[model samples]
Target: MVSSTAQPPATKRLAGRTALVTGGSRGIGRAIAERLGREGARVGVHFGGDATAAKDTATAIEAAGGTAFTVQARLGKAGDAEGLWSAFDAQADGLDILVNNAGVNGGQVRPAEVTPEAFDHLFAVNTKAPFFITQQGLSRLRDGGRIINVSSGLTRGGAAPDLLAYAMTKGAIDVFTMTLAKELGARAITVNAVAPGVVDTDMNADWLRASAEAQAGVSAASPLGRVGVPDDIAGVAAFLASEDSRWVTGQWIDATGGALF
Candidate 1:
C-alpha cells in the first residue's frame, strides 16, 4: 500500500492562509508582512497612519506575486482593534496568524523622570492593545492558529532609567504571551514572544542615525557585533507563523545579538 515515490499531494504551507500584522506600515512590522506574503500567506497590513506607507507595502506584495490588503488604525486606541479586524474580514473568512508589533517608547527618556501619563500610554500600546486584539483575534483565528507578540530585551536587562516606562510595557508583553499560550493551547493555537535587541530602525535612528561611531559603540557591545536589521526579527516571526514551530509556545525567543542583561 505504500508507494515510495508516490506524492501524497501538493501542500502549500500558507497558500490559502491569512495573517494580520499591526504597525505594518514600516520598520519591523513591514518586513514581517512582506515575509508572510513571500510564504504564500495573504497579508492584512495594519498601519496607524501614513496611508501611503501601507499602500506601498501592499503594492510591493502584489507586485511580487503575493496577496495583501491594507488596514489602518491607531494601535493604542480602544476601538481601533475592532476596526482593524473589520478590514481584514473583508478579504478572508478566518485568520491564521496575528502579529502584535505596534508599540511606542512611552516618551520617558529616564525612569526618574517618567510621568504616569507617559507610562500609561506605553502600556496602552505595548501591552493593552495587543491583549485586547488577541482576545478579538480568537473569534477570527482558526482553532489551530498562531499569535506572535513583539517585545524588547530592555525588559529583561536593567532599565535605561529614561527608558524605564517603555521597558515596563515590554515586561507586560512577556507575561501576556506566557499566560495566553496556556489558555489557547487547548485550541491548538500557539502563542509566543519575540524579544529584540537594539534595532537600527528609524524608530531608533536618532542617536545611531548614519553615525558609524554610534553604530560601532552598539555593535562592539553585542556578541554579534552589529545592530539589528528588520530581516533579523522577521525571520524569527516567519518561523513562528509556520508549522515549523507548531510544537513551540509560551516561550520568548530573543533575537538580540547575544546581548545579556
Candidate 2:
C-alpha cells in the first residue's frame, strides 16, 4: 500500500556539472560516462579513433535525458593531452569531473621479454598521458571537483609476471592519486583511484568468455563468486564524482570484487 503523493527518489546527483571521460567509447569508460550522464553531468566522451563508438555513447547519454559531446585524440602521441583539452574547451566552459580511464595492457610480456619500444609506448599512454592531462586540466577543473584514475588489481601483488610493466603503471597511478590528493586538498578537490579485477568487458572477452572453465575459474577467483562488469566499477566512479565523496580522497578503492582481499 502506497500513498498517491509519494514521490520517486532523485537520480540527478550532479546537476549542472561537466565531466570528461577519456576512452569513454567502450568498456569501463563507456559505463562510467553513461553513469555520470545519468547523474546529470554533461559528459565529454573522448575516444582515440572510434568516432562511431564515441558518438553512440554521446547519443545514448542524450537519449537518457542527459547532455554529452565527443572529443578525440590519439593518446601516447605528441601533444595528445593538449589536443584533448583543446577540443574539450570548445564544447564545455569548464570541468567538474575528470575520469582518466584510458589505458593499455602492453600485452603479456615478462620483464626479460619486454622491449624498450613497448615499454615506452605503455608508459606514454598509461602513465605519462594522465600525468600531463591532469596537470593541464587543473586550470579548467573547478575547485572541489573530482579526479578519478582507473587502475588495475595487479598493482597489489607481483604474482602476474606477464603483466609486470602494466602493473608498474598502476602503481604510478596510485602514487599520483595520493600526491595529487595532498596537493589539491587546499581547493577541496578529491583525487582517488579505482582498481578493478577481471572485469567482463570486451577487453577481456577473448579469455573471459572463451569457455565455461575459464569463466568459472575467474568467477571463483573472487570471493564474491563472480566476474566484475563495467557497471560494477562505474558505480564506484559515480560515487567518487558525486558530492557524497567530499571527505574521501587519496584512496585506492578496490572495486575488485574482493579478489585481493
Candidate 3:
C-alpha cells in the first residue's frame, strides 16, 4: 500500500535553464537574480565593480539550494559587452534568460545642466550597451529563450524633467523590445520590458528614506499606498522568464503598482 505521508513536489519552474543578470550584485538586479535562482535557474550574477557583492549574491543563491556564479565587467566601456559574455560563456554553455537590468541615472540633472559627456555616457550604458549585449547574446541564447529589459515608468511621463535623458534611454529599449521580439519570433524567443516606478532600493534610499514625509509622499502617489520594493519587480521578471509568459512577448509590463494611473 502507498504511504499517505507523501509530500507535494517542490516547484522549480526554471530547472535545467541558465540565466545571466547584469548588475545582479545589488538592488533590483540582486532581487531578480535571487528570484530566478530560487526558481531553479543556474544564475550568472554579473557585477561591474563589486566582486564582494556579486559573491554574496551567488552565495545567497547557493544557500537557498540553487546554482549561481559571479562575473564582473564594468559596463558603458568599450569591450564591456564582449567581456561580460566571455565571462558568462566560461561558466555556462548557453543562456536561456537574459535580464538587462544594469544602468545609471545621470544624477538629477535637467536639460540645460546635461553635458555632452553625460548624455553620451547615459546612452552608452543604458541604451547602446543593451543593444550590443543582446546582439552578441543572440548567438548564445537558445531558441525559445527570454530577454527581459528593466525599464522605467518615467518613459510614460509625469516624472521630473531631470530624468529626461534617462527616460529617453529606456524609451529606446521599449522600441528595441518590440522590434527584436518580431525578429526573434521565428526562433520562439520572447522579448519584453519591465517598467517599474520609484522603488525602495539602495538606488532611491537617499531620497525615499530622507524623511517620513518623503516616504509618505512617494507612497501616496501609488494606489497601493507604499513604495515598490525590488522584490515586486523581481516577481514580474520571474514570470516573464518562465514558460508562463510564452504568449506575452513584445509587451511592456507595468510593475509600478498602479502609480501611473
Q: Which stretches of candidate 1 lie over 4 Å from their true place?
A: 1-12
Instruction: Indicate the worst ten consecutive residues by lDDT in candidate 1.
Output: 1-10
The CA lDDT of each predicted structure is 0.84, 0.91, 0.90
Better of 1 and 2 by lDDT: 2
The clash numbers for all candidates, in the given order, read 5, 0, 0
lDDT of 2: 0.91
TM-score result, candidate 2: 0.95
Q: TM-score for each prediction?
A: 0.92, 0.95, 0.95
Poorly placed runs, candidate 2 (over 4 Å) = 1-10
Which candidate would rank higher by lDDT, 1 or 3? 3
Give the Cα error of residue 9 in candidate 2, in Å: 8.0
Question: Model 2 over residues 1-261: C-alpha lDDT tens digits?
Answer: 111222123389999999999999999999899989988999999999989999999999998888999999999999998999999999899999999999988767888999999999999999999999999999999999999999988888444888898888889999999999999999999999999988887877776778788778877877778778888888899999999999999999988888886
lDDT of 1 by residue, 43-121 (tens): 9999888999999999987877788999877877778778777877777798999999988885537666777787777
Worst 10 residues of 3 by lDDT: 1-10
Indicate the worst ten consecutive residues by lDDT in candidate 2: 1-10
